[model samples]
Target chain A: MLHELQSGFMAAVLTGSQTELTSVTPKIREGKLNTAQRVAIYRRNVQSTLRGALGDIFPTTRWMLGDDKFLNVGDQFILHAPSTSGDLNQFGRSFPEFLSAMQPSAAADMAALDWAWHEAFHAAEQAALDLSRLGAVPAEQHAALVFQLHPSARLIGSAYPLLELWQAHQNSEEAPLEISKILPADHHFLAVHRDDANVTLTPLSAPQFHFLKICAEHQPLGEAAEAAFALDANFALQAFLIQTVQQNIVIDFNEPS
Target chain B: MSPHHQSSRPPHALDPLCAGIGLRPPHYQALLGKPAAVGFLEIHSENFFGAGGPPRRYLDKFREDYAISAHGVGLSLGSADRLNPAHLENLKKLIDWLQPSLVSDHLCWVGVNGRYLNDLLPIPYTEESLKHVASHIRQTQDYLSRQMLVENVSSYLEFADSTIPEWDFLREVAQQTGCGILLDVNNIYVNSINHGFDAMQYLDAMQGADIGEIHLAGFQDTGEILIDTHGAAVSDAVWALYASAINRFGAIPTLIEWDTDIPTLDVLLAEAEKANVMLEQASFAMPTREGRRHAT
Candidate 1:
């Protein structure tokens, strides 16, 4: 009896179709509330719960799109996506992707950037770089050295002036901020990490960015350095490496080729 | 590292007699060097779901001084999809590392297809949901190789198609799965008030032996609705219901949860102290009533 009832109720909740309820059990309508109303309540509850998750993950995106439209997108996301975790903290991984494909008036790139940044904020904590190993390496092999970014670090590049735009939006009420002054035609690199229990983001240079990327890929030291140089010939390998090392951005090291 | 290494397992710190508080970020610093006595601490497992960081580091220090319970918020036990393997792996890792006294999750599903709602959404109290939830719980226990306490969530709505009462559904789940019950007395009280069910009757229907833990938290009576916000002190009426619960299930390990609008650590400790007093009174208050009733 328990099995039969759970299946029928799940069927109704899953499909939101009156026919499913009737087919599973005719007694669904016998309660104080009709089957439709009960199922509607569940539907409302489910959507609202999903909405709350999206709101948390994409606060900026929701702010960009009005609440009503944000809710409409939320409803669509719920229909397309079902929750997989019991934890609300883990709920919005796919939301940025959902917003990218969504027809909302906001720029897709802006939404995607916001989502990436949010993920970096919630990403796991890891130990800072090991300085002793890298310091032992010979200066002659410095160019061959590649740096590994912390596991929690993420590098995001956006075509839109997303970094500047995001900053401008935050300062909108206090004073009018202009993105045109800071906007660059070339892509801008952003590094994300948790510092002091807070997620921090800062722009990165070509050498620093590529070096970390290669290390993240776990490419050996020699190969990672080559990649960094490929991104920019004047990569200033020593200068950036010193700054990254001091910042404790690298968690581990390898032999200088 | 595998969780089954017996030598590495941490000893349990939970005391059967005292009350504990759920540890949150707001109170981390306050709890760091406090001399006050707290039975143990419980945390939302997902809060430390990240691979490593300050949260894990702080929890490690806290565990050294206080017993810990890992209460999970994301193990969607009732979902029909095969249990999430990634989620299971993460949980397994946490249990192995933390070695908490009690590992618990809700008897609810928040995700339907793939995206997670993150809230403890209601599961229909029908045999199908029951069997599915039970089998999932059994599998979870088998994987973890430990009995998990499944807590009931507060629900604002019930399915018109639900064939069994919520308590019965809960009972069948615990009985069939061989999992212990983490009875959230506050949730029961809130549901009872919202759904117009007799809280005592619900308590009467439960199997006392299977109950492993009790949760007490305040609710939001938003005038139009009663939400289980867990944001304030437990209400007077809810405390009465809790006192009744103690009469039925003597001296279960109780936790005071304050998630939103969380107050000071002292305030939570004070609230937990209140639960401890009630817990003591319940045990002492019981034999007298039992003897009087038998005299009749």
Candidate 2:
């Protein structure tokens, strides 16, 4: 009975369906406010709280779409895809995909990048790669070693220059770059990660991005390097490896199984 | 009643007489490196639920200077559905790492049927709901190997099928589960106005109850009803009620909670200072008992 009551109440608040309200309204007491008004308060609370959470997580996307449009989309998203986790941080993972489905735009790409930054911000802290361990491994056997990115590291590919867009919105003193001025690119690869306190977004070249992507798939160093070389003949694997390690991107490694 | 296991790490004890403030992210930098004026800092447990990030990193730094209270918002302990195991695991991990002086969540449910509404929704006051919530609390206390305090939530509506008073329901839940009560004085005042109940009666019911901590927050009077917004200062009426609570319950650890429209750290400390004044007055007016009481 409690389950039925809660299910009916949740359904009414989330969807505002007449049938669900019929099950819940009779069980709610009416005072200064009528039963419909009382239930409406909950409906407003549920909508605003979840909408506020999305706005917090995707402020840039909200800004891009403006308040009215963003609120509308957020409400629709809340109705269509209610949160599944008690943790609010775990909510809104699929907003980008939802936005893309509703209407593809630069805002959806920005949402993807925003989600990545969010994930990186909360991702697990891991130790940097042990230089000594790598040093002891024979140079001839280095090709067979499979490297892993930091747990906080996320590789995001988008058609828009998301980092610039995010940076532009961050500085309030300067006017935000007009979305109309920016054009879609062939591809934009970025590595979003948290190194200590800062969550940094690093732009990556086609070759470097593919190399890291391959490495993430648990490919051996030799194979990853070959893929990068395929993307560009002069791909600098040694330099990129040094930079990756220095930036705390590639955190651990294991011998290929 | 269930027995609680010893904490893996020794937790920093909060001075129960001194008032504390909620640790919001905006104040993280300003409160850092400075000696906190409050006795402890209360954090929403779900905020630090992330594996490792700025939230945990900052809490680690602040832990050195202030006692910590892990006030969770996402447990949905009163839901008819089963307790979220992942949520419990994450909460346990945070507790183990922080070793907070106090742990608390609401008596309200935030979700049902695996779909989280993410707001503190009210549950009916009845025998069945009481038993369900008590069992959930027992399960939680068992899993974490530590006793937890359950707070009363501010509600806009009351169920018609309710048999027990909200105060009685809360007290019975505490009695049944051997848990402490995180008495939100503001919620009592707000609900009193919203539901047309005597505020003094609510406090009277809580007399001799396991009142672990007191929360003082602001509310919005929307002409028709008072909403527990926690976005402003401690209202004059709520402050008066808090004084009465201290008189009745003695000097419990009180916290100033301001979630929305968060002001400067100095402003929050000022609010904490106000609660501290009441707590101090209570200590002097009455013979103070040992503030710390084990739930079991």
Candidate 3:
């Protein structure tokens, strides 16, 4: 009886659906205090709490859409998707996908990119790249150096001017944002990494994106070089490795066979 | 190392009689240089789950000065799915890093069916639910290699199939498993009022020795239903219950918890000072021949 009442109570709280709390020791009547009024408190709490979590996770998306529209969208997300972890940081893992299917928006792809950036920011940390280990590789292998991006590094490809959208929405005071006259363009590559304890994004060339993606898979330099070459044969492996190592994005490296 | 050698003796903090307050962000800067009189500080473990940040930085410094407790909200231990190894791993890391005096989580499931309610929903006090929660707590203790406390949450409704009283279910869970009780006094008061039970009766049913800590917080009364909002000042009713809890349990390390509309640092410290006074009065006062003295 305890299980039935509590489960029914939660169901009513979660969906605002009517549930009779029978089998309780005193048998609670829905009409005892007007079931709708009784259940409204929990429903308000659940929705408000979830909306606050979504606001934290998708601040950029919220900024792109005005507060009222964003809340409207939030209500839809809450009704359609239920959070799977008590951690609010994990609340929006599916939000990018949700954006992909939501009602038409001029900046839908940009919203997806922003959500991805938030994920990378809170990702687990890794030790910086060890230069001593790289020294152990033969001096002859320097030209073929392939480096591993930290587990937190992510690559986002989007067709909208997401970088501009993200830049305008930053907590900093910038010139007024003008998304008016913008249209979706060809897919652009973006490199997202946590540096100085803050997640940052930089535009990447096709070759640069593929190269990091390959190295991120722990592929050795030689194989990763071939993949990079497929995109742009003129890809400079040495220069790329130097830049990546300096950025603290590359944490470890392996020899290519 | 052998299992015996690997296991460190349970951490030693203040005696259970001490009263403390939750250290929140608003209080962080002020607490840094000030002298702390409270017994300990309890923080939500998930608030510091991420890598290095201000929360970790402040907690590290604070732990050095005060006994600390890591109270968790996201373990979801009672779910049908296996305990989340990742969540446990993060908790273990925090435990190792901070070396808190006590660790605890709710006695209810917040996530299931691939959806997390992100709120503590009550468990049916049936043998089946008990077994599931007990095994999960046992496994969590083994993995963390420490005895953790499980807290009873405020629930809006009771389950129909529950076979035992809520207090008995809680006490038995502690007895059957070696896990301790967090014993949130405010929750007891809230549940008692919501369910039409005597709060003192619930306290009497608990094993005082098994309680590792106590929690005091404020709740919002919506007339029709009381919500454990953790906002505003501790109500007179909850304070009365706190006095009762301290009398029965002999001052188990109490905590003043305020999470929403968090007031100024001075305001929180003032609240903590009030709890300290109550603890002192409860300890010094003699138990009358007619049971405990009702505080004036």
Runs in model 2 with CA error above 4 Å?
Answer: A172-183, B1-9, B207-209, B291-296
Which CAPRI tier for candidate 3? acceptable
On residues A1-257, what C-alpha lDDT tens digit does candidate 3 reach at each position? 33344455556567665434222324333433544554565578778888998887787777777678779878877878788666766776776677678643445666667666766665556667767777788877865666778655788776666776778777554433544555566767888887745777878887888888877776667777788899897999778877777676787775766
Give the per-residue lDDT of model 1 (tens digit) for B148-229. 9999999766655578999998998888988989999999988887788899988998877888889999988855446887
lDDT of 2 by residue, B46-66 (tens): 988887877777877787778
lDDT of 3 by residue, B1-296 (tens): 11111223444456444567888877887888774656678889987776553456567677767888999998887776678878888888778777788999999887765567777767777788888889999999999999999999997766445678889889988998899999988899888877788988888899877888888888988775678988978889889888887776665677889988998877777787888788777766634413223344
Q: Model 1 — interface RMS deviation?
A: 5.3
Give the candidates in order of TM-score, highest first.
Answer: 2, 3, 1
Give the C-alpha miss distance for residue B75 in model 2, angstroms: 0.6
Residue B63, model 3: Cα distance from true site in angstroms:
3.2
**For residue A257, what is the lDDT in candidate 3?**
62
lDDT of 2 at A118: 87
For candidate 2, lDDT tens digit of each residue in A39-95?
Answer: 788888888889988998888888777788889989889988899988999889999
Instruction: Identify the CAPRI category of the predicted complex in candidate 1.
Output: acceptable
Evaluate model 2 with DockQ and give the value.
Answer: 0.57
* Chain A only: TM-score per candidate: 0.78, 0.93, 0.82
How well does candidate 3 score on lDDT at residue B285? 61
